[model samples]
Each structure stands twice: as C-alpha cells, then as structure tokens.
Target: MIVLPWPPSVNTYWRTFRGRMLISAHGRDYRVRAVAAAVSAQRYGQAKVAVRIEAWVPDNRRRDVDNLLKAPLDALAHAGVYEDDSQIVELSIRRAGLDRANPRLEITVEGA
Candidate 1:
C-alpha cells in the first residue's frame, strides 16, 4: 500500500456553502478525491488504494470531508486511469479531521 499526498492547490474552493448546502457540497470533494485516487492508482497500481482527508475547515463549517475529494477522482477516470479489465482498480476515501496531518492517499495495482 503506497501513500501519496495530494497537492494543496487542488483543495482550494473559492465558493463557500451555507446551511444544508455545505453537506451537499461535499459531493465536490468526493469527486476530486476519486479522480486523484484513480489517476494515482493507474500510475502506481489499482488493487491497493486509499484516501485520507485532513480538512482545515472547522467541523461546523463543513459536513463531510469525503465531498472534498470527489473532483480529483472523476478527473482520474476522465483521464483513463483504469485497467483494461477494470478489475484491478480500487479507490477509497477516509476522513480524519481538520489539522495539518498528512492525508494518505493509497493506490495499488493488481498483477503489476
């Protein structure tokens, strides 16, 4: 299981969500994370991959960290990071807390 740190710039969101919107907005992050994980997996491997999110926003300010990682994941899929059989690819996202902690994004390719 190899861990990779995502670039800070990728987490930048100029728009802020208010009220229930914050929770729904989480979808964005989820997409980003998925894309990042996919690409990372393709470059590295698919069978093994995980994503850890370290958010800086206050707990109250956001609903779920998974939402923040979505875009990157979609990007990976769009970039064709999956395998031919699509059986050796895997992506997962785990949320921790708002800190300087290094979120570990793991990607593993089977039979690589």
Candidate 2:
C-alpha cells in the first residue's frame, strides 16, 4: 500500500488548449506522479489489481470522490504499481474522515 498527499482535481490536473503544445496541466500532474514514484516501494508489471482510495479532508463537507481518482491512478501507473491503470479491475473510494493535522489521500493496491 502507498499513501500520498491528496492530489488536485482531475479538472486541475488535466487541461486542454486549442491546438496548444501543453501536456499534463502544465506539468503539475507530472510533479505529483514524481512524488508518488518516490514514495512507492513496490511495482507490479502485469497483474490484475484492486485499488482503494481513502481521502481525508480537513472538515466534514461535500466533496466529489470521483473527481479525485484520476490523478492518483495515473500516479500509481507512474510509480510502477502496475503497467497501467487499466490493470486496476476493481476500485473502491471513500471519504475516510477529518484529519485536522494531516489531511491527505491514502492509496492501497492489492492483487486481485
């Protein structure tokens, strides 16, 4: 399992410009992936996996969990948890709760 800081929304990590040469939301996504790779301890090459995302927020509020998934999935791919996010055949996401001191995202990947 790998735990990482909460990633920005997909809207923030993915952007498009009309015929522009920009990639990965101006490299912000790449930076997040780099961090995930730095923290990852294991890598899986071609196995079906299950992913669980526990998002800890600072307070009790309504936030879209789905919006927070893409970046981390991409990060796991970059971290070499699997060859690609497509290997994650099962997924679970939940709002873990408030963490006044250290609100962040926790990701767990297991062979399925």
Candidate 3:
C-alpha cells in the first residue's frame, strides 16, 4: 500500500511549448512528491499486478476519475514501485468523496 498526494489532472500534466510536448510544472512537482511518498517501496520487477486506488478529493467539483491515474502511475514506476505500469493486469479506481483537509490517493498493489 502507498499513499500519495493529489496529482495534476491530465489536462495540466502535459504542455505543448514550441511544438514539443513537455511535462508541466504541476506534473513535475507531483512526480517528485509521488517519488518521495514511495521512498520505501520495493520494486515488483515485471510481475503481473493488480492495483486498487482510492481518491480523496479536495472538492466537490466534477472530475474524471481516470484522469488522475497517469501521473501517479508514471511517478510510482519512476519511484521503483514496479518496473512499469504495464505490469498491472487489473486496475480499479474509486472516488472516495472529499477530504478537503487532506486530498490524497491511497493505492494498493498485489500479485495477481
């Protein structure tokens, strides 16, 4: 199980600057934070995995659930939580309503 701070949405995670797509400031910050959060994680190599994600959002604004997964998935892989997100064979995500004081994500990874 891992706990990560809220991540930037896909809309803000990438930017086009001078015709090149680059990671946005929000995305870079989120990746750093995500890596820090997973500092103690053990790599899963290429083993098949099942991941469950719970999101505690900051507000009641309507949002797409899947939009929140990308940054965290890539960041976690960069953190060595797993060899790659491709190793996930099963994935589940649920919005757990608001946690205004502590908007965050809780994720669990298990062998399939």
- lDDT value, residue 21 of candidate 1: 30
RMSD of each: 8.5, 2.6, 1.0
Model 1 misplaced stretches (Cα beyond 4 Å): 1-41, 44-60, 83-90, 99-112
Identify the candidate with maximal TM-score: 3
- CA lDDT of each prediction against the hidden true structure: 0.43, 0.74, 0.92
Candidate 1 per-residue C-alpha lDDT over 1-112 given as tens digits, one digit per residue, 9 for 90 to 100? 3333443233453344563333234445554555554543435234333333343443335455555454444444454553232433344455544444554444333333
TM-score of 2: 0.81
Tell me each candidate's TM-score: 0.32, 0.81, 0.95
The candidate scoring highest on lDDT is 3
Off by over 4 Å in 3: none
Clashing pairs in 2: none
- Over 4-112, each residue of candidate 2 has an lDDT whose tens digit, in order, gives 7667666567556786644466346555654554464566789999988898986677788898787777767776778898898999999988897877778778889
